[model samples]
Target chain A: MKPKIAIVSASGCRACETTMLDIHYGVSALNRWAEIQFWPFVLGSSMADLERIDHLDVCFFSGAIATGSDRAMAEMLRKKCDRLVAVGACAAYGGMPGLKNLKKPATAEAADRGDLPEELALPEQENRVRALDGVDGIDRVDAVVPGCPAPVNLVWAAVSALVCGGEADARITYAAARLPEEMVRPILSGLGPPPGAVFAGEKAVCATCSRKKEEKRFKAVKRPYQAYESTGRCLLEQGLICQGIATREGCGGLCTGVGVPCRGCYGKPPATFDPGAKMVSAISSTFETEKPAEIQKIADDFVDMTGCFYRYTLPAQCMLMKG
Target chain B: MTDYEPKIIAFLCNWCSYVAADAAGVSRFQQAANVRVIRVFCSGMVDPSYVLKAFSSGADAVLVAGCHPGDCHYISGNMKALRRSFLLANLLKEMGVDEGRFRLEWIAASESPRYAEVINEMSESVRQLGPMH
Candidate 1:
């Protein structure tokens, strides 16, 4: 029997769902082997229709859990879906929305201060935003496809896994047949990792990056706008503070493969709890300075350390609140 | 005279600060009784994660003590620790933690008195601020 699929988005920008669709060539192959039971983002489907469904073979759930309603939605999907895969950084680990936890949490009451209609009131937001798997009841995700929008290649891998049938480790006898030689890339032509894999890969992105590396020695770290012409060398070597050193490897080093520095859209490597801490250690070690006074000056370079480091994973930070 | 005592988590380097702390213990120095020390090989080995872990784990204050500048046994290990402390300090402050709660200091092997003083000072300041959570 064809696997039943559902692409659900909670409180996210809807980028992950669209990025999944960006696998244009795989659409035909996806349609052939899996039936999309629900995709409320582009398709016309109400919450009532979703409630009507008894079971889903695979549910690609995306978004941070920022409110009571989002939590409820996740619980509802968990009961119906056999495999609940977090499809983006937001769902896999607290993404950009989790940054709100760094400050005093905002309230939904702020929306009603403008004197709108009584029926237009917003749902109460939870005190802290969290990854789907981070929540208490929805504590287990079968697997996670990590990326901001979850680079389309990883999405292709997940879809093809379901279509191929069997477990996550199952071998695909034949990948998409319609795609030509040039169209099929290495990232798109793979099966998902075994279940319980928290990330896409074991190594950090720096291990896979193709950039030319040298003895890293920089006196100053530069922000993105302060960057000059690319040397085609390592971004960290150029003092640009690329997060590749701490970020989990996958997506084929997509951003760094080109010219752009990694923003750590994928969360910390599997071994790490905080990418910011790893980044701090990386920066401190690579920087070329023996003088203790110069070290203090280098530390002063970061204008917003929290935003620079914990821009994504603030909710799961060791300190949940400043008490 | 008071029952409340702040819990201070201190990471002391093996070569310098740890030795001073041990010496202070043997010398019968009147140090604050609130500190719990974790001896590391070098202060540089203390990751920023450890600092956050201390703060989140009910510590009223966290301290990273190492060899004085240029006095590291590993030669530059202390330098790396100093640099990480500055950055980690800013990170903690920005997260709304009191700056006084996290500190980095140079305590040479011979400066047992300084180790005693540093711990007591931090413990008093933390007591004024109350418990972390």
Candidate 2:
């Protein structure tokens, strides 16, 4: 009596192969508690086979948002699945396709290359791509997995938990930082913050990093090369631009710990709130310089590195490129 | 420190890095033994975290070698790698980690000798930066 789970993948994402491979190996390690079914790639034996599939206990949607006939197919899966989960950055956060949220010409050189198939061809304009959350009338999704092709472990763990009925205790649950009741409550009421609401030192990390000789802090603002000293002080305090202050702290600060800046992969509303936007606003006022474009480019390139993870998903939230 | 030799993991793209590394070996270029090469389909597959993973897993340094920006075998894989490297370096600096632990360079298949030279250069730089913990 194994629990049944189905995965629905689209054409452009091309993650069906990788996800299938991961699931095959991942389930081998699991206690064989669930029966797996994949659509399109695996069970597309015939049109009758598609109709034969009824509402599934669990369903995963992977790939970028598609339109025309593809949209109808996606909607059908959404209706037939009991528990719907968005896997992979494209499905979960709109990946490269979501970049249309911001009005910008595509800058990714890969977008023009012929490696990816023609099915992924975006609309000629920036208004085309949208996150699943942005699709009108869609309510909350059960869960989301982020990453270019959402890491194999993420899919395995989430599905395993659902099958075991301990989904609430899943380690990858969404845990956004709690904004002040004063700021959030009013915003919920449709009232924006006061004109001079300066966001400074709401948390200890921000306070400690911005400390100006008021407390015992590390001297000398270190750059990428010099910050490697074995001191545990925040790099931002030492005059280096660290995005960890605004970035979510799940990745074990891998970027900061390894002599790089936080690219904001785990930050904000992957659909609306851009991690790059928050980072620049936080530092722009502090690190004032004449050459603003140079600093902006450095920040832009950082977010672009995550590719579809950050850029394509929350194009509007991007600090430099907007999209 | 007895002439600290940096242990570097070089992720060579199949077309460029692999060919260049092999050429270096064939040309008998005198390079540091510290660098170990791993072949990947393209530089785009080299996630930024992979660089951090290498360093944390006892690698003194990690180098992501690819074809020049426009020369990726899979079209824009190198460009993606470049974009990723740009972010990775900044992320490392933000984390209070030493920046020299990661290096991103481009080398052509015809530049096997240059690949060896780059490896030796990175080893020297990491040696000066001290061991990453």
Candidate 3:
């Protein structure tokens, strides 16, 4: 029997839809075992069609819960589906829009000041904008596929595993499909599965990066906008704030591979609490300063510490924002 | 409210600051009885998460006391701690935590009076700021 699958987009940029479509040739293989019952982005399913559905085998819920309607839709889907998989980072860790948690919630008065259109003039429903995990009844999801837009191969592996009557192990599937044999040989050499092997690999991005790490100390940290020589050394060693040391591995060190620093979009290692806190600890330990005033001077070079540290996971992790 | 006692979590380095705190107690230095000290091997060993945890877990203020520069048991451990303090301070500011709520100071093993003085000053400042939210 074909498993009935439903795909829902909540409040994200529709990246998850792209991820699903990126499966490309693999979709033909998937179609043999499963039927996509409801996907508004692809199938143009209306709300009436969703309400008419009595049962669903699996539901891929993408995007963060950003409105009262989104919460209601999530609850409805949870009740109608046997299994619900949170797809993409927005659904799992709140993604980029989660940064808004740092600011005060929008008010009716602000909306009325000609800043927003008439349709958006009203205040958001109370407690509407939230991370998917923060929602009351749907906190415990069956599986989480975390990424800005989850890698296509990983998505294929996850959906395929589910269709094949097996649990989707993101770690095993991702490693098998993405990692080269040479890389896997050293990693599998007498080593247990890493600590946080859920959505991404256990080690930091630096583990996969090819940069040389000679000395960790730096007199001054450089912003990415400043010109510097990339002499096959670690970006952090060259005074750039490369977050590879604190970020979870996966994405195959895409940003760092192109000489750009990682912004820690993959969330934190499973062992850590807050990625921002881990980053603060990691970066601070490398500053070569003994004097109090000199430390402050070096720290001052990095403007907007919170924005840099909690760029992606602020809404989901920051203690102060957890009201 | 006038008699409200503030709770301060003090991370004291075992080599210098912890000894200084002990000396203050043994010498009967006049100090506020509000601080709860947690001894660490060195200031560098104190992760920023510990400080954030202290604040979130009902600490009215957090004091990180280390050895004077160039005097760490592990060479430059205190310096590393100093750098961490700077990063933590900015992070706290970004989080909208009051500036007076977190402090870092260096006190030698013999500076019992300085320890008492710093504690007293921190206590007064935090008392004025009231309890952490």
Name the runs in model 3 displaced over 4 angstroms. A24-26, A108-118, A121-128, A166-173, A176-197, B1-4
Model 1 Cα lDDT, one tens digit per residue, B1-133: 2778888899999999999999999999998899999999999899988887777778888899999998999988888887777777777777778889999899999999999999888998888887666
For A66-95, candidate 2 gives per-residue lDDT tens digits of 454345455666666666676665665566
**How would you encode candidate 3's per-residue C-alpha lDDT over A147-213 as one tens digit per residue?**
7787776566556545544433434664654643443342344232222124456678898888778
Candidate 1 vs. true structure, TM-score: 0.88
B9-118 in candidate 3: lDDT tens per residue?
99999999999999999999999989999999999898898887787778898999999887889998887778888888889988888998888899999999999999
DockQ of each: 0.66, 0.03, 0.70
| Interface RMSD score of each model | 1.7, 11.9, 1.3
Clash count of each predicted structure: 0, 13, 0
lDDT of all predictions = 0.76, 0.55, 0.76
Tens digits of per-residue lDDT, candidate 1, A218-288, equal 67978767766467788878778788988887756778878678888777887886777778877877567
What 10-residue stretch in candidate 2 chain A is worst by lDDT?
A193-202
Q: Give the CAPRI class of candidate 3.
A: medium
- Note the B-chain TM-score for every model: 0.96, 0.94, 0.97
Candidate that would win on TM-score: 1
Model 3 score (lDDT): 0.76
